[model samples]
Target: MKFRFAMVCSSNQNRSMEAHFLLKRQGFDVSSYGTGTHVKLPGPSIREPNVYDFGTPYKQMFDELRRKDPELYKRNGILPMLKRNLSVKLAPQRWQDNAGDGSFDVVFTFEEKVFDMVIEDLHNRYQVLMKTVLVINLEVKDNHEEAAVGAKLTLDLCQKIEAAESWEESIDDIIVGFEKQHRRKLMYSISFY
Candidate 1:
């Protein structure tokens, strides 16, 4: 059976969305979340981000940005990213707000800070269910190119995990080979609920 998976990031608009898009296309059981207090997107200036509440629809963001500056948003890849995100889910969800909804077998975070936040949130939830979830962090830069590459790498790792009879048993070896092949360091934590 396929494991329930989650992809999380600060904004859930780039790195997390990219991975979510890839995982969903593969027919994997997956969801994504943003850890930030508000969903933020790049604006005309670095200081002026287009911020929205966590539950705001991706379609709305796309429409707003398209209306504001279609050419600029398209050039920076924001328009395309939002379009893909809208196709994946209704909105950018906040991880904290999603706690009581359900649990994932594995949670993948694109950055260390996001990983830490997820781990902390899980820890604070307490172990009412006694089920274990593996949280893995693969540092991916928050850029279009990096997100695309990171999503592919995450997909490869998921394929390996899905093939194993017992993921807990083979995870170490799988990770070793993955790290060697990709030449990237991965950080992980185990949390229970």
Candidate 2:
């Protein structure tokens, strides 16, 4: 049985979308989400951030950003990121808004804050299903280059998890081996829906 997977990040524009595109291409039952109040993109200055609601269409954001400052947006990679996101999903989804999708067997978060949000969201939801999900945090820097590297790492971890005869039974060994091979500490927690 293949595990249902979710990739989560603060805004879900870069890191999560990067992994989502790769995982979907590989035919994994995967989805991506954001844990932020609004999807945010870099603007002209540090104080100014382009923010959109969760359900805002990626195409709309792309067009708006292109209009706002085509050269700046394109140079910063926001335009390209939005284009990739549009190809993957029509709009950005908020993790808090989709708590009912607690059906995922594994949830990968790109940062510690997003991991905490996922864990907290689960705690707030009713545990009617009592389904156990492994929430793993593999910190990935949020940028075009880092996102690509993170997506590849995410795929590698997913492949390792999927290869186990019974992931639940061999989870410990799988995690240990992955950490050793990758030489990175993976933060994880077992939670119920």
Name the candidate that leads on lDDT: 2
Stretches > 4 Å off in candidate 1: 100-102
Error of 2 at 114 (Å): 1.0
lDDT of 2: 0.91
Model 1 scores a TM of 0.97
List pairs with backbone clashes in candidate 1. Answer: none
The residue-by-residue lDDT of candidate 1 on 24-108, one tens digit each, is: 9999999988999999889999999999999998888899999999999999999999999999999989889995444688899
Per-model TM-score versus the true fold: 0.97, 0.97
Off by over 4 Å in 2: none
